[model samples]
Target: MNRCYKILRTVALTPSIGPSSIKIVGAQYFARAAIAAGEFNSTRDYASPFDADGHGSHTASTAAGNHGIPVMANNFNYGYASGMAPGAQISVYKALYPFRGYMSDVVAAVDQAVEDGVDVLSLSIGPASVPSGPSAFLNVLELELLFATKAGVLVVQAAGNGGPSSSSILSFSPWITSVAASITDRRYNNSIRFGDGQSLIGTGLAPPTIGGVFFQVAAAADVCQRNITAGLVESCQDADPFIRSLVRGKLIICTYTFDFESEAATIATVADTISKIGAAGFILTMDPDIGYEQIKGATVTLQVPRVILNNMESSSALWEYYNSNTMRSRSGIDIGFRATTRILDGREATYTWSAPVVASYSSRGPDVNNALLETADVLKPTIMAPGSSIWAAWSSNSEGDQYIKEQNFALLSGTSMATPHIAGIAALIKQKHPDWSPAAITSAMMTTANFSATPGVPILAQQKNKLSPTTPFDFGAGSVNPSKAIDPGLIFDTYFKHYVQFLCIVPDVDDMSMRRAVGVGCPSKKTDWCSDLNTASVTVSNLVGSRKVTRRVTNVGELDEKYIVLVREPFGVNITVRPQVFKISVNASRHVTLFLVATQTANSYTFGEMVFEGNNNHVVRVPIAVYVSSTLGF
Candidate 1:
């Protein structure tokens, strides 16, 4: 299901309005220039015409620009949030429109960005999957993205909120950049409370024949009331025991429903009904289903003591009891119910903005549709960034809603939240290498990426236990390392023409229909093979052509900087960098590069360093694998 739930959140773009919102534009010519030129500009002037969401500003500054804050962007100007590039300029473009023409406008804006000389374009929006039509709306976007590669623009798009599964498809443009959002170990404090109101309370004592128990039935819309009010009252299927357990005048346990009613109306109804019925508090169960809003119709009145069951903890018990045939037959002392005026406070729970792994909501890769899959089989999103509970500029026009008063800052999640980080980094890279191609930039960042685990921490699920490192489904190519990307010794560069050639080699793709899907002809593999296409080809060339790219560091203790580098084509690869000594000058820096030759497979390698000693104080290892064509059977 294209739904968001289970700690997974989406980064949705707010409706474009004033300062609090995002405005999008078209980029019809952007991608083309990026591929051709391999270089662009990233100016950092806050006073530009596009002063949209501060999200871009924050991400830009952290990844590349020179913003001077420590908390939000981490003071590096290109610090914590400083993307792969630490010294790039920034160009702000506000081309997004309201919900109505969002896609068309945004795509056009991307084209425009290329025309305006933007080397990288980042988008935080996504399309809904409607199956009854073309493969999916995103598939169409993929075709348009081809124009970007032709234009030499590197497009970074966010993975959708539909996640925890591989069903979701990232935008399938060969040259369009795709990114997924990851949670960090950061948190924020917030709370929701129930209001007070009159309530009906039911009281009943358990009989010796049955287990000890007390029952209550006080509050708005109890079971009996719902049946009778509906007139054609059936015996409230599967609800008799729940009802009989409650006493006539005491506290009664009942389910709450207010999703359909306005917040104000629901509150008013609860107050009036509670006063008339006379009841105590209530106990509510956490929802098990997933969605943008998992808890629905949960009405808690402050007038009564409300008890909440952590569904994660109580689900097992509820399931066991619910399945018992004699649950309702258990005898108990019959105690009359009662009505009363009482109040209770709501429970408080604060959620963290960052946690390990991708939010259970960000979409996955392996774009279906043979015709569309050919361009880039690269797993999405291309990388991960902070998209959970990120604080950014909020629209000023949203103050009218009772639940939300207009504020300068707002918290959001989703690929929308991560895109700005990459865009900012693009600017930084531009600042350093004004003539670098989008491919060169992306390749540098991806190749230099590391997959080392943190010290004193065991990989865990729910903060406990450890799993094997092969869990690619959860940690794609491991976590992203921006610092390493800037200086990646080896790169896995991809070009638009090469990606298109892969599509033609697919056994099931309909060549005639491919044109309709991507607006391009499939290259012929026979005689006039596309292997010679004028695209940037990535092959397993010798690091130094037998020269062996090597370096020496002599300022440290006599330690074996013993290292191992291997390429696993598209399947598995490993890279290790070990220092043989432990002694070094306090104010000196050391550097080295591990190289992995690329094979004919469209894959990349990861790096890490296993601790030879028990002290756990060594840098992690990494692997260098570049994506290559398997047509020649590498």
Candidate 2:
């Protein structure tokens, strides 16, 4: 039976939108599989394409899982879960196992997926870093994707988790659509109210204690009096050391340290320890040495009332309150445990209604060329989508994060979660406009993204611990607007040959490398400038005095429309577009020239946009990024 079908047998979901039917097809597993024991099993090769790790299932369902499925875990209904395209079909190509796999296996999977005639290819994987080459764009993975694009497959990939840092994008080829992660309007928070009437906020997904009344608190160190334990006994790892009488009805405080991060300790074990000792509930405080939202399995559902103080300040305050109230002897033996608190039921959901913020972990870009980090004239990630705290399908095994096991659903985060949103949206577009090329589809999305928001509210990006206005590097064309994209009046389409020509002109790439990468020699006629490639976005990594580039836009709408060009010029560059106002008939194309001149030398990158607003309610936007080196030098 299909893996998804097996899961539906257990879901008591009254699905409104349906997966109606999940027919598994073209299922193949090419990599050596790894089971839960962390041992490689060669005999498992060519087995069923079942998701041993929940990550693949989460991503797969995010793109095309059945809609209106109630997200249930720990016997609590958090909310309804849905995919971008519920009616779409899924074909599994298992390249990597739950734990890890080789790049060669990944290559085989991509090649096979393309051969199997899949419409869209969504990959939540990429190179660890910039691949070794004169031009990182020519790596084996990039070349395979280039060929896939040539075969009319829309490839979407994770933009890497390297983060708010500049020039950290891993997706290099313009042919592939790279995706950045964003936090959604939904927020998950739990609070603990102390006896003094002060409440401290924390994170968790669990039910509240049986009653609303405050319960006495007990420290793990006091209850688990293990004088000769090997690990951090305060972590509450073992039930043997616990003084059950003291912990039976109290909210036990457990320490979260690096051990939890390394899997030496786990939230599952802590929950087990709490159960074994019959404690009323548990509070996991951050170990000062490792603070901030680094708690793994923090979102896992616990049957017991639980709260994870992920922030240092909140953990410190809770600790301070506990220490001040407790009376201890000179030898540090607890004489009295007086801290009292009640954990609120966190299973209920809440909405912030705030605009999606670029996740602090999503890789930013100026699309670099080499390992030295020379910026390239390409934009990445091409778009952004909700990737943080997303609730999606999970394999009960939970092989990826062992701390979370035997759950049919999971709340996960990463750029990996974002990539499939674009892929699913692209599939919808392809279904509507069967004749549209991959480039046309990509342009439609780029030009119409970030549309569903209140006017004048600039989308902000999370930097380290602060929020700032996002740039093209932070979110390519902004968050994707699927509705507007389906009717984007104008699209900048690219040809496979254009990519070949662009590769020939890349800064350090040579003819020999080009032959090896693409299986073809450079065309006799050399392209004048790399920026001339017809893409929805324009970027000049190192601009000097001035440069002129031309872009051709095709009318993809049903009627002729007149459009006026608008420019939000970059800080140090002045822009001019000829034939500012023009009309184009349906199925026709128009070429526009943009003249950019250096107004002042800017040592850093500055951002801007060029918009084409049509009379027929179609808006096309193109992001521009430029780094000015010198006013008069190359």
lDDT of 1 by residue, 548-630 (tens): 12222221212323323322323322233334334344223344333333322333322222212212232322222223333
lDDT of every model, 2 decimals: 0.38, 0.81
Error of 2 at 246 (Å): 2.9
Regions more than 4 Å wrong, model 1 = 1-99, 130-140, 189-355, 371-377, 399-405, 450-452, 455-475, 496-564, 567-634
lDDT, candidate 1, residue 359? 56
Q: Write the per-residue lDDT of candidate 2 for residues 264-297, one digit (tens) a residue.
A: 8989899888988998889999888886575778
For lDDT, the strongest prediction is 2
Model 2 clashing residue pairs (backbone) = none
Backbone clashes (count) for model 2: 0
Mark the regions of model 2 whose C-alpha exceeds 4 Å error after superposition: 1-22, 32-40, 43-46, 132-135, 226-231, 238-241, 258-265, 289-294, 370-373, 451-453
Candidate 1 lDDT at 219 equals 26
What's the alpha carbon RMSD for model 2? Answer: 4.9
